[model samples]
Target: MDDYPVHQISEVVRHVGTSDRNFYDRYYFNCAPRFDGQGQSGVDGPFALIIGLGQYPNLGVADAFAVLRRGDDHLVVRASKALGEDRMDTSVGPFRLEVIEGLRRLRVVLEASPDNPDLSFDLTFTADSPAHLEARHFDRSLERVTFDTQRFVQSGTWSGSVTVEQVRTPVEDHQWSGNRDRSWGVRPVGEPEPPGRRADPAETERSCFFWIYAVLRFSEFVIITILQEDADGARIVEDAVRLWRDPERAPETLALPEHTLRFAPGGREVTHAELVFQRRDPSGGLADPLRVECTPAVACYIGVGTGYGLEQDWRHGMWQGPLTVQQLRRAVPEIAPWERMLCPVDNLVRCTLSEDGGIEEGEGLFECAVIGTYPRYGFHGLGDVAE
Candidate 1:
């Protein structure tokens, strides 16, 4: 990599700036068949797929996972490999990513795994709007840095094919839209560390009280908002913005964003939500607010077997030897008992933006997680249900 004159420092590309074992770079994407029904869940259409790839330079490991969910069938395929000096090669086993044209076009491929021949996809992503660089995410637990990362989000359309249960379906850009993000930095990955003065879950400092991240794509513009609040509803990490496809137009930063979420009966799964983004007055005072209503169209539990939160045996950056690939398929109802324990409840949310007696409709991804205690939502502790 040094021969290409792209070195950021004196060392080669393999030598990362940090020696922290948790330092990692990752790419994540999610896609679903475009919504065409009358607010239906799209269960009759193609399955929704989520793909993730991560490389831990210090840990010398690279891994990738692809998960597909449609109605009752849930399928996941994960692969891990020993990292080599060439970090440029972003392939692990049968999964690989191709940067067709950098930020403009990208492709993700997952060949059929012999162990689990039920799910595979080859999809190309074309950017619909310029990528939005999000605010830097930095958090700490006690004195140790837990998350220090930078990420960029983009909304796009996907074109290719997906095969599940040996049935291949074409993915047309006209009927499929997706969003992706690229982030890299120090974060928790792999196995848990030894119990050395571990923080208590009851402590507010150690728990994530409330969190919501959304990337909504409309025909003319895109909206991206992120919120992380403490148990008392104080803002910890927050960002709100509206982006456009025109390069001449700058990203609009929203102000004083608020959320009103309605959870399922006694559960934390968000059934409906209304996001209010206030405008800034000419003198920088508070102004009127713009409300966006969201409803879940299709839901995907991310932690099922994708090595995300606490759902399975494998995790990102974990060493699984030279090369390993595995797949899991389960009936959706069988996993319900433990599904609620997962961190995020990913949903394809249809959004309606209402302002000045007018409405514009669109759809995108809504990633949400609420645990510990969030008084704003009436959650009192870990595993507490919404009332």
Candidate 2:
């Protein structure tokens, strides 16, 4: 693949900058149907799709997975293959991703396989808002660098068709929207190693991770906010920016945004949330705070079987064999056991937002993760459910 005229480094494209075995580059995408006032999809049934592809340079592995959620049923298709020098070949078995245009358009295809005719899709994503580069994610645990990565986000409209159980459904750009993230560098991938002596044994009990990432897109602009906190409720990472639909307009960064989340009874599922963004005046004085209210419509559990890792046998960059493909169909009722075991359950929620007193209705994604001990949420330790 480096033979193509796209080399930036003196070494081959496969030769990454780092020698770390966990060095990786990945692409993640998600799309959900927009519901009308009646809480129904434009078509027959509501559905959401989450797809990802990852490459581990040093590990010599590449993998991809596509998950389709329709109502209570989830269909997952995963594939893994040994990495070759041709990094351009992103296909694994029947799944492949195409970069139609560098940053403007892309396509993902999951061909119907006879081994599992459960789900397949051919979706094209077109960017509706300018790509926003997020803050670098750098975290160290036990004096070891656990996560160091850079990612860019883009919200877009999707158009294509999906087939599930021999039934085909059309996805229109006007009625469906999604967000994609391209992240590279190092993070936890492949298999887990044996745990050595703990740097601090007491740290396990106080461990907590809270993350809230939102990409709310309206006709005029898009609101992208991210908040991450540690066990003590101290901010680890924060980003709040508003991007306009027009390319020329500059982006606005909110100062010290605050969030208040309301979870369902006895569970960590967020029912709604309120985000307050304080704007700064040109004189460097604090201006009025902009408030946005979010109400969720549909939710998808993203960590179960699609390689995010939650009691799942398959994981990204893990060498299963030369080539492997698997499928799973899970009913929502049967997911409770896995849900309880997984900490910081990742959820992709389709939500409607209302800003200020005007009630400007806009639909987008509200992604939240809450795990372990957080005093602010009344969760003091692991296995402690919300009231």
Candidate 3:
């Protein structure tokens, strides 16, 4: 084990993460076909496909899922398995996630299985921009530390194919563009509440905010923005926005990005936003602003399908013990019905941005989870309403 390559060694091998029950490491990405015409496509056709893999070290389990939204259909498949001591092995049944060339490139494979015969993918992602790390301090509470948290965002292109419902769609380099993020930290994972009991509002308040993260790729640059606001839409706990010009050539760096987000009537969804890029003068005065206008087209409610804190059967790392591939396959169908009924991708928005007076359109993945109150996204009765 000592002789193993640095990239091949997993964090679990070194016990590097915190002892928090919710500690998790995850990989998430969204891919879609390149827009052909000008402006935003407006969610008229096949939207996007999202894939994720998460490892909960303390709980001794790992899980993976894939969701494809084609036209009016939303198809999803999930699998989970016990995490063995060998962290180097990143395969969970038919799903296998591997780093082919460390941060620069990685591969994901989902072989055909009895439970999800119509869905499988063999895709490789090559990073187009250097990974940009987000600020770690998210919550206001100092005592309840979300420890050892690290996140890196990258804009990348996908190459390979994904089969959905017996249809194989090839994703050539530059033809299908997307962004990926790697996050590892103490987050809520696994079954937090007793089976069939509603989660307490106080417990849910830990993450009671609406988060919007959009990564837009253009001909010359890339724009990444992240915003997190509290339950009453008062405090902005996390605000990170940046631009990378010709990211393919230069090393990634952080810059001050000023922006305003305007949501729709209910304040649950973003309708329009204006991002201004500026630099401070030597004397601390603001410089001329470079402006961009963004209009949302489509989005996905991430929690709906991923099951972050929703259900016991869908929770990450809920797998109890060592299981065979066939047994895992058999378990998927039992949860498939629940996935369809409860999990809906409400906001996977395809967006259009006007930058430098040119209308450049692209597809982006966005999600909002309002835990305590009546969120405008129609998740009213899902959980107990906080007072």
Candidate 4:
């Protein structure tokens, strides 16, 4: 469907993880474009999807291109999650065995196969002639059974999978270690307090906030963040991190100042370095103000003389997808109300990312767009009238 409105993806959410550790949630906010690089031509396509998660550090998706012959009316998708682990991950392939004559469904199956077959498929509507407007229904039953077998299999990491599609020419970034910042940077100053203790302070609340540190990695590619408050509040931050050689780099072999930040899951980064403060106020009041107090007040890359930097590419953005609102409403009636909520997840929201791991049709900031799909959603990112 051309410029079909955004489908309000509603899902029963489930969270699993330790209390202190980073947590994640599953929401329908993930969305991709409807029609992709299928040439510049398009009629109304189908409601498609490429889902994703927020702050999910480890999950990734892989797919393959296959054309089923006219003989076998069915296909199976099965695969392993971590290759050598007991945890077999699978997805609910997005199609089912249909009896209709001449129907095509391209599935971006999920990874909950064998055990829980739950994923989505993009079905293009076709008929003997152009006059057939009859709609298709979303099949919960087909969603029930997984091929329990046929999965688009590939090797290597997330970036590798992109190469399989032969659609990406990655740009990487690198940096040196010899010029490491001996000081790892500091936090903002705390609130002022009295040197002496006074009398009648009433009921007070103690608040404790985490100085959250995020390390995002896809296989061998990683991005680290150690956030602190804007001490001077001038919209600038300076960062200095001490660097040291673990194996003691040979001045002859290893490049001077070249620091390696493994992007793989267990790759290491300095985590949980922080300072805590306790305030004893006579007046019963709130807890101490919690703000990142960075010594320099900003985050920056102080490239030493080596002039080296980390690998390049933000490694963010989505792939293309197709989905018509009218088609979706016909497919799954549960989303009837969502038809009214057809808008970006955020008001100033500029883009939408799908979970199936593709860049669905949507837009945001002027530069805000899926790398190539250039999804042609209505101008506002959704609706009947193009934005």
Off by over 4 Å in 3: 1-14, 38-44, 140-143, 146-148, 194-207, 232-267, 275-278, 281-283, 324-363, 370-387
Give residue 92's lDDT in candidate 4 (0 to 100). Answer: 16
lDDT of 2 by residue, 1-387 (tens): 655897777888889987888789999898877767665466555467889999998999999988776788877898999998888888988899999998899999999887558888899999988899998888887887877888899999899988888888889998888899999988878887556754355867888778888888777899999888998778878889999999999999987889899888777888888888998888989877777788776667777777775744677788888888889888865778437335343344444444444556677778888887888889888777778
Candidate 1 regions off by >4 Å? Answer: 38-46, 199-206, 281-285
Q: TM-scores of the models, in the given order?
A: 0.95, 0.94, 0.77, 0.19
What tens-digit string does per-residue lDDT give for candidate 4 at 249-352?
21111111111111112211111122222222348454442111111111111111000111111111111122101011112222232221221111111122
Listed per candidate, the RMSD to the true structure in angstroms reads 2.0, 2.0, 5.8, 25.0
The whole-model lDDT of each prediction reads 0.84, 0.81, 0.63, 0.18
lDDT of 3 by residue, 274-339 (tens): 665664555977655555566655444344445565455567667645643322222222334334
Which ranges in model 4 have alpha carbons more than 4 Å from their true place? 1-22, 25-40, 45-48, 53-88, 92-107, 110-387
The better candidate by TM-score, 1 or 2, is 1
Best by lDDT: 1
Q: How many residue pairs clash in each candidate at the backbone level?
A: 0, 0, 8, 82
Least lDDT summed over 10 consecutive residues: which range in candidate 4? Answer: 175-184
State the displacement of the C-alpha of residue 184, model 3, in Å, after optimal TM-score superposition: 0.5
